[model samples]
Target: MKHLNSQSFLEDSLKRKVIFLTGKGGVGKTAVAWATALTLSRNKRKVRLISWSPFESFSEPTTLKSLGITWHQLEAAACFKEYALKTLKFEKFFDAVFENRVLKAFIEVAPGLSETVIAGKVWDLFDRGEQDTLVVDLPATGHALSFFKSPMGIEKMFATGFVHRQAGNICDMFVDPYTRVDIVTLPEEMPLVESGQFVEHLMGLGKFHLGFLWLNQCTPDLKVPDKIPSTLDKSIRECLEDHRFRLEREAKNLVEAKKMPLVVKKIPKFSSEAVKETIEQIAAHMEEK
Candidate 1:
């Protein structure tokens, strides 16, 4: 992959209409998303961070309190309420149509419909001109695709009139150029492979405009032989040589930068607070345009 600094790639991505951060679980997508939101807010842009995890609350004020940003949890109850109001606003007729006992019973029983309603609410957020930047802390790999592809799936699964129209409208939000996808990964083998698959899947969706390949927890290069060879037995020398070779393998790949996807490489590891710091670094690079 092309050598990337988070600062530059992030700065460039911010120019797009919508910016999405996604990846397999435990890859730090949420932290990076929060950091992006915080950095954009500090740049004086109106921002909102939305989390879709039902079990975990996104109420950590300390995460962005210093940066003057708020994280909103998209719990089921709140989503249902927001969905009801937004639907009522979209078509005044729905105010009464959705009130029927039969329809209410359907929504109550088929919770999947409730998920569709939440998707509609997300589409509305983009339409309402509420904020300059909207950061979505999406579900992990297994469900993130469903969240983005739900409208299309609903349209196909239920080939009716009203529902089809609604799905079409929701799909429109995703197809717009303002939206894009970013997948986070580690340098290790499995995550890297999964990240590649995520990128390929997003490309298949055709709705994601900007694709970001973020390699997190990267070990900083100890290039140029920074450490002198140790005075040790032959076996230790062989081990050190192996370590040095592994570190420089990718650096050698940089020779053909244009052919590879740009990567935002972060630190190997850090504490929770480091999340913000890493994001800040990314946002700073994103601003370099």
Candidate 2:
């Protein structure tokens, strides 16, 4: 119901301990997450940026260290290992149990075990209070939603045990007011449609707050004269016409975005630059808002 500019959005985000950024694939969710982390870091917050994926492995972004934000790439195997080590309190015991082929095979066969372990790792980060902020560049929409909901699935699947407790803890963190989910989307029909459905799904989960809807790469409004000069070249006029059509389409998408209840922020299309520079530019714009 309320609208927020970049500045207010950043300010509001600073109040949350954890922020999960997600959207359709190739919608620039990672870039927005990096910019949000950098903005918080620049404001003197102790921030950590986490890249989370279920199937694929990831390397930490090199730019994170330069921006003074701690970085971690979350993988199921690594998280499971760390959780096992901590709980068992002995590396030898963990290795013996986990390294056993039968147990390992059973774990691999478990439907949501891997996802639960990864969620536990994220929960541990939040529970430990090691950092002021955690920014999660989550996987795309379907996987991301399942990732967040893994805790609940685990709870139902396991009546009581360490896994169940871990699930409960992660679910608690997820439903807490301090944890926010930010959805990033393009100013296009399919993305907006998916975003709206995702928001409703999150709401259905109950108490999982939808923080912001980021409309990235929005076409900037062009100030053009009502009457085209007869002296203008034909090719130039055609280009102008194309630009006008794009602007019109963007306007319709924006109207649809504004109709949603969540706070919306438009990130302008930036010029091609190095990844670090682009993140910096986005951060600057966030501050300006």
Candidate 3:
């Protein structure tokens, strides 16, 4: 892959309000997401890290916890209860209405209603206006797409009332150009293929701004020795040639990404302990001209 600096693509040196990171599972998306959040926080930006993983807990991974950035694990059940209580607090009449077992049961039974509740809570967080940057460790590509589109989809199904208002507000936040969608991927073939398809799907929606295509765990593009050993077996020589060709192909893809409307970020393969350092490297790359 092309081993260029990260800052080359971040055209705007100013602060970013929101950055969403996503990719296929087990591709280092979460690590990159947390690392990026910490790197931005070091610049004195108020950063919040969120994970939508169903199985994950409120406690962030040790790497992220050590950074001291605010990490939120969004659990649907907890979010629903929090939202319901807040709504009830605001409208005593609603509390009285919900007091009726039938009304409460109806809301619980409604299809897609649970998703709407979660969207409303997410909107409330966005609207609170405290943090400058929100780094979301979103679900896999498909689930993330659904999460983002939840507001709009639910709005259409239930067109009138607070739900509609909440969805409208959330949609505005999403469509903002400053909001960036960062797709994390490995240098391997499958992840890149999925990332490409995800990009295509995002484009088809004509919604949301894609910030960058991040190829993580990239094998560094190292310079070869000046002279090859003549004694090397033919098969070994062919393998070396193939490796070089593959690297060249990756470099071409990076160039193509550079030409796109959004920027592209590349991170080389490193051990987990180096995650923070990697993020710093990424931030430094992004800070470049």
Highest TM-score: which candidate? 2
lDDT tens digits, residue span 35-135, model 2: 99989988888898888877675444567777777888887766777887888575664476666777666666687887788778888899998999999
TM-score of each: 0.75, 0.92, 0.77
* Better by TM-score, candidate 3 or 2: 2
Each model's total of backbone clashes: 8, 1, 4
Task: Highest lDDT: give the candidate number.
Answer: 2
Candidate 1 local lDDT, 1-289, one digit each (tens): 3322343544654554556677788887876777677667777778888777635554567757765776666655456555656544656555565557776666656635655665676666777868887777777776777677667678777878555678887787776766766666666667766766665676578645545565665555555455646777788778667767766654443332223354444434443356457666655544544
Q: Which 10 residues in a row give candidate 1 its minimum summed lDDT?
A: 251-260
* Residue 23 error, candidate 2, Å: 0.7
Residue by residue across 1-289, what tens digits does model 3's lDDT show? 3222234443331345677788998887877787677667776778888777645544446656666778877766556556766764555455565457775566556655555665566567777868877887888887777767667677787878666667777777776766777888866667777787887777666566676677776657775554666789998777777767767777866765565445566787654456656666665544543
The candidate 2 region of ten consecutive residues with least summed lDDT is 1-10
Would you list the rank order by lDDT, best first? 2, 3, 1
Those runs of model 3 whose alpha carbons end farther than 4 Å from true positions after fitting are 1-14, 57-61, 90-116, 231-246, 252-261, 271-289
Q: Tell me model 3's lDDT, rounded to 2 decimals.
A: 0.68
**RMSD in Å for all candidates:** 5.3, 2.3, 5.1
Quote the RMSD, in angstroms, for model 3: 5.1
Clashes of 2: 1
